[model samples]
Target: MASLSLRQVIKRYRTGKTELQVIHGVNAEIADGEFVVIVGPSGCGKSTLLRMVAGLEEISGGEIAIGPRVVNQLEPAERDIAMVFQNYALYPHMSVFDNMAYGLKIAKVPKDEIRTRVDKAAKILELGHLLERKPRELSGGQRQRVAMGRAIVRQPQIFLFDEPLSNLDAKLRAQTRLEIQKLHRELGITSLFVTHDQVEAMTLAQRMIVMNAGHMEQFGTPEEVYNRPATTFVASFIGSPPMNLLHHAPGNRPGQILGIRPEHLDVASDGWPVQVETVELLGAERLVHARLGDEALIVRLHEGEGAPAVGSTLTVRPRQDRLHAFDATTGQRL
Candidate 1:
């Protein structure tokens, strides 16, 4: 495995004299064997950035390097990277073993070495029993695993995953995520994963790049991004209920927005007075949706705590240490 670097990377599309820049200058350093995920909402250019790294998309400016070589001019095949696409892209007629062996075959690897490599990958992916089965015969998760196994056999210096779990059901997605984690642990290949899913980004990434409107908002561990978001967008986008940004929160300065998470606020005898609008029971916890001077906020209540009745006025206090402050105009952390 080798390190990957993106220095002032930019991508632009030109039509006649009209030029549309999609990816702004993005810079990042991914260490060897580190799994970094590029995550954002759709149209945020996360996938485009990953494609640039994969050599599928040409860079309009700046440099991309894999290890010691600058790969801006390199073809995808010459980048020493294996890509796992969203659609699986498996050959229906080819069995699992044959599908995984096709690249080596094209490279003219010896038959015994091909067998050894394919066998090893199959064992790692727990697809040994399905080696003879065609893609059509396998389940969606199994097909994805087969795709991963195909990448494993090549043993590329880096792995690029482009929303590979999008097609799976919720349960299968969770299962496949575990499988991917195990695969990464076993292979230790440098991986760049691109996805719009925050949960996937949080759980799968060693370090995550949070992108917004073609800009890199933040690049840090999940905990760092979640706990100490660099921008209001990062604060609001990374969580389940999202961070609450109060424009006119009590004790807030004129041009500042107060931010707090649902779980970080507690029902108290004295604090911000809010009229309960709704309550949602989520088994182990409850979400209290309330209105505070036309501003909405959610307070998380753990099990054993009574859910407040709708239309009732209750006071919720945000944990002092957990509060976040941002500039209202810039939406940037203070």
Candidate 2:
């Protein structure tokens, strides 16, 4: 296992006469054996940054290192990193054993050693019984597992995944997520994952790097990122329905915005008057969509609490300690 570091990395695409900057000076330090997930919306450069570390994309500027070696110029093979792609990228004609052994064979490893590595990896990924089947014969989850086994057999110092769970069904995705978590625990190799899904980032990452339009917004543990977001982007990006940020110009703190999470909002007999527009029952969650002042707000209450009826006027107040303040112009937390 190895620590990974990227210092002020940038990626630019030459478009006819214009040079477009994709990743703008991303700096991150990942410790050995830590799972770090880089998350953002589509077109936010999360995958671009991962590919830079994999040497699949050229770095526009700055340095990337795996362990102690600066791999800005090193070939992907020499970098000791294995990557699993979103599409699985399995060869339809090759059997699982062949797919898993392909990498070791390319490295000119002895046949016996390749077999041992493939067998071990297959067992760990729960693909031992499907070794004889081709990708086309395997289920989507199995195919994805084979892709993971292919990477695992390499036993690289770092594992890189770019939304590897995106292609699966909901049930399969959850199941595969558990498997990946179990594998990471067993191996404890330094890993960097790229995804647009906040839930995936939260569950997989020991710490997360939240990126926005070509910049790092927040880098913290899942709890830290959720509970103490450093920026407005992070507060909205990490949660499911997102935080309810009202445009309230606090009398003392003029021009600053206050953010209150949906769960932290309390609707009682007293507070700011809110007119409920709709109440959505989401199994365990009841979302009361309301208008507070001039802005629309959503309050998430427990299903057992029984949400307010549409058009009902209620008082809403947020827990003072849970309130987040941000500089409106900069979007930075206060």
Candidate 3:
């Protein structure tokens, strides 16, 4: 395992005559044995940053270090980092055992050591039973596990995951996410995971780095990123229904753009007057869509409780201490 440090990292693509900057001076310090997630929308440069760290992409400026070595000019193989991609890049003809053994074989490790390493990784990934099966024979989850097993077998200094769970179905993704967390606990490798899914980032990451327009919006734990977002973008990106951000001027009155989370807002019997527009009953909770003047406010109430009828007026209020204040001009947290 290794600690990764990125200092003023940048990436640019030269088209015909235009120099497009994909990443702009990214800086992060990932400690050894830490699981950090890079999360942002498509074109936000999260994947670009991770690829740069993996030595798969060139860094236009600055430097990246894995442990004591500056790996900016190093080849991917020289960096001693194992990367798992979104597509399970398993060899079609190769059985799972051979696939896991390929890296050690290419590295010229002895045959017996390769067998020992492959056997260990397969057990860790619960792929021992499927080692003799080809890629086509395994289901999607098993294939994904094989991809991870291949990486784990090498026991590299750092692990890089680029949306590895995106290909799986919802249920499988959830199960595999737990497996990943457990694997990280057992292996204790420094891992940098890139994904746009907030749920995945929240569940898998010890810390999350939120990026926007090639710049880091925030870097902190999932709870810190969720509860105390540095900007409106972080606030909007981290939650399920997302934080309800109303556009209003800063003041103690109704002018302040009140940031209330859906879970925080309760459907009380008495509060400010608002018209209930719709009611959606989820398994354990009811989502009440209401209109606070022109702003759309959603309130969550207990399931099995009768919601107010459509067009029915009810009072709703935001908890004062729970309100997050952002600057009017820049949308930064105040």
The candidate scoring highest on lDDT is 1
lDDT of 3 by residue, 1-334 (tens): 8999989999999999999998888888889999999999998999999999988899999999999999999999999999999998999999999988898899999999999999999899999999999999999999999999999988999999999999999999999999999999999999999999999999999999999999999989999999899999998899987888877412444434558887776556665577899988788988888877777877777766678899998776677778887776688888
Full-model lDDT, candidate 1: 0.94
- Per-residue lDDT for 94-206 in model 1, tens only? 99999999999998999999999999999988999999999999999999999998999898999999999999999999999999999999999999999999999999999
For model 3, how many clashes? 2
Q: Candidate 3 lDDT (Cα, whole model)? A: 0.89
Quick one: ranking by TM-score, best first? 1, 2, 3
lDDT of model 3 at position 120? 92
In order of listing, the candidates' clash counts read 0, 0, 2
Off by over 4 Å in 1: none
Backbone clash pairs for candidate 2 read none
For each candidate, give its TM-score against the true structure: 0.99, 0.97, 0.96
Model 3 CA deviation exceeding 4 Å by range = 249-256
Q: Report the lDDT of model 3 for residue 262.
A: 72
Residue 294 CA error for candidate 2 (Å)?
1.3
lDDT by candidate, in order shown? 0.94, 0.90, 0.89
Best by TM-score: 1
Candidate 3 worst ten-residue window by lDDT? 248-257
Candidate 3 C-alpha error for residue 23, in Å: 1.3
